[model samples]
Target: MADLLDQKVQAQSLVDVVAERLEAAIISGTLEPGSRLSEQALAASLGVSRGPLREAIRRLEGRKLLERTPNIGVRVAALSLRDLKEILEVREALEGMACALAAQNMSDEDIAALEGLIEAHGEQEAVREGKGYYQESKDFDFHFRIVTGAGNQRLEQMLLGDLYYLLRVYRYKSSTKPGRAKEALVEHQNIVAAIRNRDAGAAEGAMRVHLRNARRYVEEQLVEEGEAVVDPAPRKTGRVGSLR
Candidate 1:
């Protein structure tokens, strides 16, 4: 069991290749959510050793993109509204804190950079809303810069870890949702506006609103496409807690 778990991580090359391939598969829907992964079949297809494949699987499992069954092997984890809320709850708090810190610490250059990202996000949305390729890479760099420069190593690590699967899920689902590209543009503008104002309280509030809207939009898509089950929690506004 230990060896199987360490199989992919043993070599950087193998791990990188496997991780990239698996992520691509998930995002392309070539490896559909909830579809079982056959270790041997994938090993052969990728032309990699079983050890490396297992290691890649372990990494994906850690990211919550894949789930391990008891002696039955692995499958893509189903994204549900319940899980979305739970993940978003944490994401909101951490991101809010990050944005608050950014608001206090951001330099003039940082502010300009962020504005550029917001404008690029709008451009991406405009093209996509017209049924063109939705390019969100520019928007991604904005969040990356904020989290990395927030002077919180632990927070950076956590955010980086979630980004892998989060990007995959977003690229796949957002492409299918008609208005998402445009909505994302507005959401980003709101976040940028709060940060530029340097209002920590408002920054945090705006960040939460941005994330909650994204969560709601994504979950709505999942439900409509028969991909997830919406599970509502009693209003927790003004209330916060942890879910280990």
Candidate 2:
């Protein structure tokens, strides 16, 4: 009886577990934007009660990964190209700030770990195929660490909680463009070099330039495909901080 009670307390609840699985699917693009989330189907597929499934969805909704309509029920959030530009704008400032802080605050061990991560990325099959880039998630893992290393709790939560996931979906969609992967690798190296030297200004500048190039690539693709590019010019948001 004691063992049973202890196990009950120790095991993850169905809701939290389900929420995590659903969140992963969303992030991985397995559940594409605007995909309907049917409660009945999801509960049946996952072999869970509707009650727990609903709870799981509620959690995802809080994370901004799901949206519920009055009569239509829940679906994954879809971002417009305009929305993408706006998001990347926020990412430019926030991540640039993160890079700057990481240069100042990250420990020597952490910096070494980042170098090792970059080295590992260089060995990926994609890189060897002359693709020359880390997979989307692997690439994000590098940025995620830097964001966390910033040591700002609110900033960490804002980036990791919502914006990053949305960015991942878009980036995964765009990752297939020829030559982009190779270009991203070069930019990643530049950002890392600046951080290693503890040049906060250089680190932030490198990060902005990298993301700007990425945004430009997306814009060029959209234009080539005959889609309207909203505000193609990148705006200079005021400096995030005085980078030392």
Candidate with best TM-score: 2
TM-score of each: 0.67, 0.70
Give lDDT tens digits, candidate 2, residues 1-82. Answer: 1111112212468787777667656654557566666676566556677887788888888877778777566777666678
RMSD to the native, candidate 1? 9.7
| Tens-digit lDDT track of model 1 for 86-133 | 777788799889888888888878888888866765666344563322
Clash counts for all predictions = 1, 0
Q: Give the clash total for candidate 1.
A: 1
User: Candidate 2 — which residues are off by over 4 angstroms?
Assistant: 1-17, 44-47, 120-140, 152-154, 157-161, 218-244
Each prediction's Cα lDDT score? Answer: 0.65, 0.69
Q: Could you give the C-alpha RMSD of every candidate to the true structure, in order shown?
A: 9.7, 11.2
Q: Which residues of candidate 1, in runs, are more than 4 Å off? A: 1-14, 44-51, 113-141, 153-175, 229-244
